[model samples]
Target: MDGYFPGTQSGPMDTTETFDSLVRAEFSPRTSYLNTASNGLLPARAVTALHEAALMRAEGRPLLPLHENVETCRAAYARLAGVPADRVAAGASVAAHTGLLALSLPPGAEVLTAEDDFTSVLNPFHVRGDLKVRTVPLERLAESVRPGTALVAVSAVQSADGRLADLPALREAARAHGARTYVDFSQAAGWLPVDAAQYDFTATVAYKFLLGPHGAAFLTVPEDFGGLTPVLAGWVAGEEPWDSCYGPVAELAHSARRFDLTHALFTYAGLRSSLELLEELGISAVHDHAVRLADRFRAGLATLGHEPLPAPGSATVSVPGLGVRQPELSRAGIEVADRAGNLRASFHLYNTETDVDRLLTALEA
Candidate 1:
């Protein structure tokens, strides 16, 4: 498997040995873990971090102050999203932030989205009775933007098909219409470079690609954006949450922390550890490795007389004829998903050429 794909390195520094070694060291060695799009596998270090934090709390000697740990996790997510720490807020889930962002828009705002986009991206706007929601195909999203459209919401990557959205083009169209962009990067954040500065608001759940627990997520909002108010405000959203009880007037924080929700501290602890690991590995390397593996997997499927769905540069591949064989494959320790009628295998940095080989062998069987 060493030279299966020539010139697959993203750069001179990216070698298969280094990539595989890191994956082997950090991730749990499963027979094959090809379902990262659904939920990522936490590294051993992250699991240990969660256990230690829980133990410290049980012993009455916490690892660090809760606020300090929260800030640390927020900073880690900020770095991952390539945004300033002040512009990032912690949320319970992508849906929570999406609802918050949708509610922040002006009354009767027109929101343009895609039909195939994640429900979290569309449901928030659709539920607003005063807002005008228009659903179009991803290819037609840019052209669907019109005057008076206040927001354009979409996912960075389609969850089922793994189609990457053209955020730059969408942003350009939205900008021309004076509309803001909201992106859910749940499938793209860890394996892809999501430009947080390009969109007005972006969110991703930690449990999916960030290799952390559920019930905690990160949202990025522009620091200078005005006219947006927190719809789900709590004491954490106040300017001085600790002194909120004594204040006669309620004032929200000047930063994106104004949207913060009470988070699960244990989840944040695991997220901090995993984020640190990802940062150390460099997201570029992780992305390149995942993409390379996906390319190889697609090529393998093709050789097996199974042409995958047309999803260019996607880490997830969908084979046409394997949908019915999903249960058998899973029984054989080859994990994947049956998305509609397509059998989908999602790759991550943890997946290797050997994993692809195993999948191909199972299909042949």
Candidate 2:
């Protein structure tokens, strides 16, 4: 059990080595994959891990190892998020994790949100019907936090154009107004450094920048549980799950485990490998490498008279009015997305200079 959750420690590099070896050994994309914002390509290790887990099921082997994989991922995410392992809860849907916060808010309380933030971050609040879901432009979110704001919900990185939220500013405003903050990190984690300790709560799906499959999510919460009543609590959320199996849970989990939904066991089996690979590479290195590629793409777009959405320091570049070319690019063997009328391409540690140049060449043709 102690071997389940591993610590993240990448020994110092003396500058002679590069991430080239690790990436080359781990990934072999058949096409130019620049769409990590939509979905990341799985590393070879994760693919192998998934296949093994499926085989275990086919052989009717004990699921204890796969169960162990969930703890490994949760711990990895906690270290990546700069939180305690006990503070992170495993789940499958970010919207479902968000529902905990939405349901916690009293009637008529306001949930301040960025106008175009991802829907999963805002939908839970709206579905509550009793909570006031206020929308302002992403740039105006921090300034818009008022005394009426009970919670400020926003994506750490805008899913549409990669615009990063002013988190430090938002935190300050929320504190001044005695409000809580919920940040969705689905678009930024793994490449952009995340510290969930700064916000009241944070949710991230493992499929995007984290380079894992869909259906695995992690949520971090305050140690005191932030007064959140787990409305969907099942037996897994019990203090002693096996003992609590037959009753209305005798005692809820003392930690954030109380918020745990059933683990996506298969997803977790693969995600453990993904998280391990990310930790080995280091987020700072990944950020610098990806952002450089994005800047290169932006420069190329400028030369082509194509202005991208203005998002400095982001690894994702979205070119407005070029969404119509998505199919052309795809046919040209480039993977990207047409998001909200923009051609969105995200660069990851696995992407190369050639990948960026190929997209530029396609755009020029």
Candidate 3:
């Protein structure tokens, strides 16, 4: 993996230098892609892995062997999230995992969450009419926790305004109230160091900052989590799925693997490749580089008489003025998102200072 790319260095390099090399080695210069919050651009190595997986499938290879790729992906995600590999479960999407978690919670429970969080986090609990759900501002989340609160669910970073949640404080408050904590790391996982160990449950969509294909995601649950019942039980979730088919009683896996749903095997292979690249580059370096670019973009927007939202330590920057200009900017080969009436530009390792300049130039024009 050291020399997987041509001219790749053997040891660590400066973050900027590594990013420049990554831009050259991984991505094509077709457009200034600053929409990682919406969908990430897959690196060349990940694409190659996907291609090879497709070729194997075309050659009539069994999908059973690819199950190992799922474990490999789970381990990679666990490493990134600073949790044990056994605590991780592969899924098709954040919604699937959240729904499964919702089913595991006590009936008629009270849940607290942020209104600005992604819909997947809120919808699952909402659809379960038995639970009482309350939405509050992210800054007030810690204070909003009460004695009756059964679970607190929120995103590590708000997708709408790029606001990061005070996860440590929130976790502490939830724990004080004897409530469990759940975090959606879809926007923060690759670019921000989110320790999944801090929360009782954590979920991520691999297609975003993880830089993997769509339809692949994972969830992490605590080792001692009780009330372990699988609402959408499948043979794969069983401890001995092969033997369970012939038995009268079904025994689920003791670990978080019991929560896993069926997923695309090739997607896991692609995710493993991207996760390995992330590990090699180092998440802290990626976070710093992305934050620097976001800061630069925000400062430049401010100088141009636009106010970008203040979101420290976030790769995404939201500019209200640029929301209406998104279409024109897209025509100029600049990619960004108009999320919830704010124009958002999300930076990643493949982005550079030049890309920020291009975005500022497009906005100014």
Candidate 4:
């Protein structure tokens, strides 16, 4: 599987130098966080922004500038996702935006998704009394589309298996059934390529893979879906947030800005800094770096008599024999996550092939 980048294989690049050295070699040090999608290591730009935001907050400045920052970030993110600024919505988290979208749908509408969908997806459908919820295996999503399916929710990369879904095919099936498509891009946004205009709504958590702080997220709603209401409506969604009286909810901002829960200057400042780091690093190259490292990792694990997931082009590697591999690899400073009966190792720009070899050699011992 292509984890980092498929069809791009050179030799192991140096990783022993300081993290700062690696960052300067490319772009900002923050851009090289190998665990960006998992733990959200902050980028340098975001760090600076957070500092500025914190200082402003300490001085008791108004928080409205954060709303403007969200708007600016939305426009910048739209460019990255190849969509217009109006199609994006900045929010505190994916769950917050999902709540907004769920409110807009019919009361009794049906929501379909894979059983492996992330936890936030269950919030809207499971809590509602009238919404009909149905879930099948991840493999069945492609063929499960039918009438009455108001929305087909999915994760672009399954957090459980790190498998990348066939987005185009899913989009086609959802469109055929007149169902809206919602993708949780928390796992796919930074490590891989994503386009929001292709789907009805794509929610992204900036903390994951984007190398930003927590509580920063974005939702992309197509112009056609403008009728959807914001469940968490506030002064932000109104035509003029400072307006004394509420009006028609400001028509939902005509952009992702409608999803903003409240103005959060410090967090937004941090996230914007991380976005700037990504802009400097060139995502195409970043994808290549991650794929190469993950490929080597997978190969090394295989040589040690462990089998990874069967899919191709996925960065996640699942190693069996936990008792044997975990302790040995841990001693070598290699950390991995365990999920769904598999040992998961996620590779990103900061990882190197040497790190892979080190883990495999530990297993050999």
Residue 56 deviation, candidate 4, in Å? Answer: 2.3
RMSD of 2: 5.0
TM-score of each: 0.92, 0.95, 0.93, 0.85
Question: Best by lDDT, which number?
Answer: 2
In the order shown, the candidates' Cα RMSDs to the true structure are 2.4, 5.0, 3.8, 4.9
Q: Model 2 reaches what TM-score against the true structure? A: 0.95
Arrange candidates by TM-score, descending.
Answer: 2, 3, 1, 4
Error of 2 at 116 (Å): 1.2
Best by TM-score: 2
lDDT of 3 by residue, 1-365 (tens): 23212233322455445645765787775898899999998989989989988988899887675778888888889988999988988888889888877887777898899976899998989898888899998999999999999889999998988999999899889889998888999999998987999888889999999999888988888887545566665766778766665544278887787877876888987888898888878787777778878888988988999998889878999987567778888899999999878999999887878888889987776
Question: What stretches of model 1 exceed 4 Å from their correct place?
Answer: 1-18, 245-250
Worst 10 residues of 1 by lDDT: 4-13
Candidate 4 shows a clash count of 17
Candidate 2, residues 58-88, lDDT tens digits: the string is 9999999998898899899999999999999
Model 3 spans with C-alpha error above 4 angstroms: 1-19, 242-249
- For candidate 1, what is the TM-score? 0.92
* C-alpha lDDT score of every prediction, in listed order: 0.81, 0.89, 0.83, 0.70
Which runs in model 2 stand beyond 4 Å of their true positions?
Answer: 1-18
